[model samples]
Target: MTYPITRSYVAIAAPPLRSIPLHFSAACLTGALLTDIAYWRTAEMMWTNFSAWLLTFGLLLGALAAIAVLIDIFSGRLLLRGGLGWLYIIGNIAAFVVSLFNAFIHSRDAWASVVPTGLTLSIVAAVLIVINACLGWAIIRQRTGGLEE
Candidate 1:
């Protein structure tokens, strides 16, 4: 008996647009992880110690997420990897909501309003969640009858 090997190429890619949301969510989670660590250690000075860096990190992360989302939508491939897609989708949605609350309520100040900032994050997160759900559905539909391979 003998076995044969096959070669294949996949040129079509899932759009990077949807990737934006995942990126932002990922960044936020990263920043939050850092902040949470600092908060636990420094208490009152956590914001003073790292707020600026975290804010910038979050902004950039959000921007990237938005770009990824757009790419995903344009290319029609939001559900990039099945299980991983769910991770990115749910994680991002939850991260976005928590980010809004943290930036707006937990980090509010007399002169430092976070409404615009948090709301902006929320929008990206929400958009990504919707896109992810759609993609998940489509991917599942594609795989329901047989193995994806």
Candidate 2:
């Protein structure tokens, strides 16, 4: 008599977007927002601390996330739930717009009180980004059937 052998397959829980991309997005945005805040508070030379580089890096990360999101959306790997995903995109857009305005104002005069206005907007955007990132991770975990993988 021959014995039957069975193989068991375990499913890995893959997120909508990998953790690295999401984490990169959060880190870059947080760094940009903090540097901007520091400049706003101290009226110091923002560029001395490489604020420009930080902002550029944050924007690059955001762009990468955007590309990944679009690809996932089109390929049906990520489903738009009209919640965190939309909020994430919106927050990024708002942050970009505010950052652009801040850059313009900063070019005019870094010490002006008006500089804070753009910085405030950026802060709000950063908060939204953070919230959206958390929500996104939760959603992905839920979709993948509980964070086992």
Candidate 3:
């Protein structure tokens, strides 16, 4: 009699819940950039307010995401491959810092807020967020072998 060969595989997956805050933070940061553009085009105070609130929410959610990442690292659920993880972390921190400064600039009078500095900061932050998101997703995909659970 011939016996059939069997194989077992171990799956590497990240906690789905950990990514939720990151997604939201990205959305909020992108929204802030849009609102900043709107305010620049129309000089509307409401848009300025919207930008401020979006930045605030984005930063808060980013903090939550950072905490989750830290937990994963400490718990050995996440492994840094070729320092991509550190680059992602640094990019995120830079984005948050830029957004924080933009939030403060938004607190100024409406026109002065979105004219040049605020709008520039929003653009920079949005770009940084995008880059970091790409890096993060790449890391995740590499770890999961392109399968996310």
Candidate 4:
């Protein structure tokens, strides 16, 4: 066996995953805000103007998500995991899928018909989901490293 003389090491940045709860919640809220703002601005263009229905559903979902996230955010614990986390994931995934459909199939037909209401708003949802996923994954991964609650 031979021994080496000099050793070189590369430094890798550790991600700021400790703040996943706050990051995820904040991103989700921001994403929703963006999508809603865009929707409100272009409400006149959509074929379906179910503003009341959309408002009710959005409030319900947003309240539940905000509550769940707030619990964890305030406590610095994974208060919402497993099913709750999955619920959030499912909602975001649904938004992403719907946006994909709107962006590609429904919205592409006409420049005016679908772009304003379909894919353009969907992109905001997609971004929110992406941010939430990254934050959630970081929190979960930190568990294996014996991070403090």
Q: Per-residue lDDT tens digits of candidate 2, residues 43-126?
A: 677542455555556666766767777777887767667676676567556766665564454445555523556466557657
Off by over 4 Å in 1: 1-15, 18-21, 44-49, 79-91, 109-149
C-alpha-based local distance difference test score of model 1: 0.52
For residues 88-127, what per-residue lDDT tens digits would candidate 3 score against the true structure? 8788889989988988988898798888999999999989
Tens digits of lDDT, candidate 4, 26-75: 45434444544455466543423332234334434544555655665466
lDDT of 3: 0.86
The TM-score between candidate 2 and the true structure equals 0.72
TM-score of each: 0.46, 0.72, 0.86, 0.36
Model 4 spans > 4 angstroms off: 1-59, 78-114, 146-149
* lDDT (C-alpha, whole model) for all candidates: 0.52, 0.62, 0.86, 0.48
Q: 1 or 3, which is superior by lDDT?
A: 3
Q: Highest TM-score: which candidate?
A: 3
**Weakest lDDT window of 10 consecutive positions for candidate 2:** 105-114
Q: Which prediction has the highest lDDT against the true structure?
A: 3
Q: List candidate 2 stretches off by more than 4 Å.
A: 1-3, 13-22, 47-49, 81-85
Model 3 scores a TM of 0.86
lDDT over C-alpha atoms for residue 113 of model 4: 34
RMSD of each: 7.9, 3.3, 2.4, 12.8
